[model samples]
Target: MSPLFPALAARSARPALRFGDQALSHAELATAAGALAARIAGAPRVAVWATPTLGTAVGVVAALLAGVPVVPVNPKTGERELTHIVTDSSPALVLAERGAELPPILAELARLDTDITGSTEVAEATDTVDRALPAEPSPESPALIVYTSGTTGPPKGVVLPRRAVAATLDALEDAWRWTEDDVLVHALPLFHVHGLILGILGPLRRGGSVRHLGRFSTDGVARELSSGATMLFGVPTMYHRIAEALADDPELAKALTGARLLVSGSAALPVHDHERIGAATGRRVIERYGMTETLMNTSVRADGEPRAGTVGVPLAGVGLRLVDEAGAEITAYDGDTVGEIQVRGPNLFTEYLNRPDATEAAFDDGWFRTGDMAIRDPDGYVRIVGRKATDLIKSGGYKIGAGEIENVLLEHPGVREAAVTGEPDEDLGERIVAWVVPVRADAPPSAEELAAHVAAQLASHKRPRTVRYLQALPRNDMGKIMKRALHD
Candidate 1:
């Protein structure tokens, strides 16, 4: 496939993106990208630290159009994380917002005479002259290198090829029925795959318009939905917060009536939250499954009765299988049997960047081992059990899923958020512990009350032995819970 800028430029006069008060047509966006790309064409890689705005979008697409691999670093990240990403990527150029502090890597780049630009002014160039650059990227050529949340170790860069990105866009377009008329609300952070691939590229591939929200706020998201956004994509936590904020406001609830589709992913959406969102907005939330390594693998249909706990069927061109510990294939129709979830498709990442041994260990034959445990119902819909690495809890000679306990904990009326992990125990080997964020700080439930709450829903061995109150659960930049970090 040709570079994304040229493909988008074909519809130059059409509206491509909308920021706070600025709108850019496809031609204008491409022109701005070309100008920026020209300045950094010789750079091996470019790092960007800006919020999700139209300017950042132009810079990224432009860098790619110029054949420079773009690494999107979160603007809110600390200096240490920023340094690691920039040094590992070895970016020759850095684009940051004016007045934003530069990390040490940028200082090193300056010492090396690399080009680094920072500006608050949005690109105003409307001239349609397209500068010549490498138009065709090889299918295997790395297009973007996104770093994972590093649940196991330090974050490793995940290299995605142009073809893989294109294929994911194609698959999303077909599966989600995205059309040119759809106006998407782009509110998620751009550094993560959910926002970049699902929130941006997925809509743009269908020639849809995107309104980028710099940050997620309940009122801000409500305002965008009220502004006639046809489709919305966000992580589960964002949706849950929005639902909580709008629980008492009927007008705000009415404002969300214009949304045709609401998608939730990145983390599991609690079944209770899903029902609450549907009750408040009168729109069913379609939950999908994906990670940084794969753009999108499966989705619960928008038109169908969305199963509360299932992520539904795999998308077209995506193949999924469940295997036992021995790697033997299991029946997808078994509703109670759980196994490892493996995937294979054109959208899967080629490999983790510079981690050949990890990559070799990641694949079983040709299928990518997702390290996620899942159970498929008789309808072929899959429900994620938990992560294999961090979700196991041992108690009374029995193994339990922390997700199962967390799911039950989230059902409590007083619970706002929940995370479960195993704490060391001499008798049981490992004891189940729950960290809960309560809805009301003044009247938070005690550990005994929470333990009783879980005892009612879970098996005796699966009940949490301890419930700790926390202001918030530890999460990485992508909003995934860091259970190991909590343990530490």
Candidate 2:
């Protein structure tokens, strides 16, 4: 088969994209990508640094069509981070938005006489012929190299193959029931896998249109949803912000009524936010599971009853196996037994780019060790506990998963978002502390009231010993709460 875009081009002639009043048919998108591909034929890699926009979408697909690896950098990434990524994955070409300020790496590229252009205006001088570079890239061939968000050490490059991309699109389409008529509201950042694979490529693969917003704003998203977007994807924080916006203006909630599916990923969706959104908008948030390495593994189905805590079953073509610390498989029927979530499937990444030792350590036997702790129910549903490294909190000689306390805290009416962590204490080994962002500023609940909120839902040991109110919790680009920062 031809590359993803060329294959998509033959399947539909309908509008493939809509960004702020700009709409492009499949034919137009193909033509633009083909022309840009011809221009960058000699380049080895292309980097894009803009928020979600039509041009950003076109540029990314164009680079892939041209047989070049696409590197998407976070807009908030500082000069030091950008420089490291650009230098590590040296690119011959760079496509960015007009007047989009360049990171230090781009400035270095300019000094090195590399080709960089404003994605909005494609040069007319380039060749327009659609050249078939290679129909099937090797399964080991690197199609895209994305750097991790680096919650711990320096971000490592994750090299994924064309086959992995194809697997993800196919699995998502089958699981989510994405169709040609569906229109996705693309507001997530392009640098992350949730946006690149799920937000942009996944929809386009099924001949759907993506309504791109340059940046995520509550008002802007409300306006887009009002226009006519059928599917919407966002992190938990973005959904919380929209929920806040709806409180002030009830009309905004009506705009979201048109959406058939509202997805939350990149982080755990707080149970309080999930239930609040359902009551407010009359739609239950579909929380899915994925990461930088694996594009998408599980989703809370739209047609099925969305469980509050579980992330649902594995997608088609994806196999999930829970194993104990000794590398033995754990049965699904086991009662409340938590183990490491392991996966073996086509959707897994080829390897970490240029890091053989790291790649070797990532897998056990043939299954990729996800490093995430989870429990499988009798029905095969998976509820994530937390990462094995940081999930375990020692409080009063008992080890606890922060997710347990966070989930319970989220049930409170006054709490909008919550993150739980272990703090050093002289009396106990470590005390369970809760940091919360209230739904309303002036309506902040007292610590006693919040503690009561937890006491009503959780056991005595699981309840937090201390509570602190904050305006916002620190988060990475992908929307995962930065629990490590809470200690400081």
Candidate 3:
């Protein structure tokens, strides 16, 4: 209901953000954003070179303040992906960090560079501070046109409105008991929902502060948590590293134990890593569930148990229900019954920018089809089994989830990382295939040993019929296992 950044206007020298060595107080951010917003006020849309820098944060805030739709382009994007997004979005202007070398891919669009230092610092004493900030934009007006990672096709632009972003942040505020006093820290990339919306805007809306690690490391996490940060946000890769370090690093354990909340998302936090972190720190890592199409639909509540392997109940104001394979709504929560997760609420994206067919297909009635399969427990906690497209394996007429089997394999001391998929088979409809990165590459665990370990923990049918070893599993920037890449 309130403006997304009510904290920026009235400031008293409180620190607002930190990235590597760069820092900005609330007053400084308002001044800088005000200046940038004024320069880009009339543009229909803008593209942000979403680097892990203060300029990126200032540029995004400025665009939002100016009521312009922002298309965040990842800096590490490939040639084809870069060309497609730049062509599709067709922004009136591009905002990037000053003096930073950009691929000639962006040579066409008009560009604006943010000056975060001597040449570009926004000062509270600026003449524009008293200038009337534009009237707040309508809630339904498009705020961001974030493009998906062209997994299925060329990336489709997801049109998220002001209402959706604001509502999701407010719901998280209630769920996490988030407030101005809480200072958050994370090292996630800024292009997506987890980092840009919740990691950045969520705290800004609550009038709190955030410190970005620029790049993630156990040492960086330890330093920030020990300094003043109250919360730490990371993906499973980050946590996996933390879990490994805690076995030898007392400082890392102490820092985690002293923090208020440690959260993981983007992919399922392996139950093994979850238990290890909890056992050492006496604090369980909270998990949440959502997608690019939806900002955040559910999270483990701060007051609730950090249930290992489960993303806790639906976020406030979200209507969540699972549907069976027959397309019937799953009403009662009988444990272990798998279904596709569907959600309806203000937190949903409005459309796939320009693609009416996709917009039409993404929704049934008002609910968005997440394509994610999960089982709901009696108390409303949702444990995601895996994605319907890749992580669900059908073997010998029985449906199987790769997540649980991968978790089982991870429990083995020899396995450092694991991913499971289904491949064509003659006798069985599809056979489970396990791809592993082993701790001991010279003497990797054998198929038989891994099979027996899985069978002891789960049904024998769920064991991988075939095993593959790799030096490392391919992962995206978000730490999600690129299951499709595993095939190649």
Candidate 2: worst-modelled 10 consecutive residues by lDDT: 111-120
Off by over 4 Å in 1: 2-7, 98-100, 110-134, 394-399, 424-427, 440-452, 455-458
Best of the two (2, 3) by TM-score: 3
lDDT of 2 by residue, 1-488 (tens): 54575434573578787777666777667766666666676577778764566667777877777668888877788777777788788877677655566766675563211122433224442344243333445655667888997667667888877778888888877777778778888577888788887788877778778887767887777777787778888888788787667778776788776678888887787776777777788888788887778777887766667877778889888888888778999886553677888887888888877678989999999788988888877878888878877776677766577786788877777887788877778998788788999989798878888777776776677678898889998876667788878777
TM-score: which candidate is best?
A: 3
Where model 2 places Cα greater than 4 Å from the true spot, the runs are 6-8, 110-136, 247-250, 332-335, 394-399, 424-429, 438-452, 469-471
lDDT of each: 0.75, 0.75, 0.89
**Which of 1 and 2 is ahead in TM-score?**
1
- Supply candidate 3's per-residue lDDT for 218: 97
TM value for model 1: 0.90
The TM-score of candidate 3 is 0.97
lDDT score, candidate 1, position 328 = 99
Q: What residue pairs clash in candidate 3, if any at all?
A: none
Q: Give the least accurate 10-residue stretch of model 1, judged by summed lDDT.
A: 111-120
**What does candidate 3's lDDT look like per residue over 390-458, in tens digits?**
988889978888888999999999999999999999999899999999999999999999999999998
Error of 2 at 460 (Å): 1.9
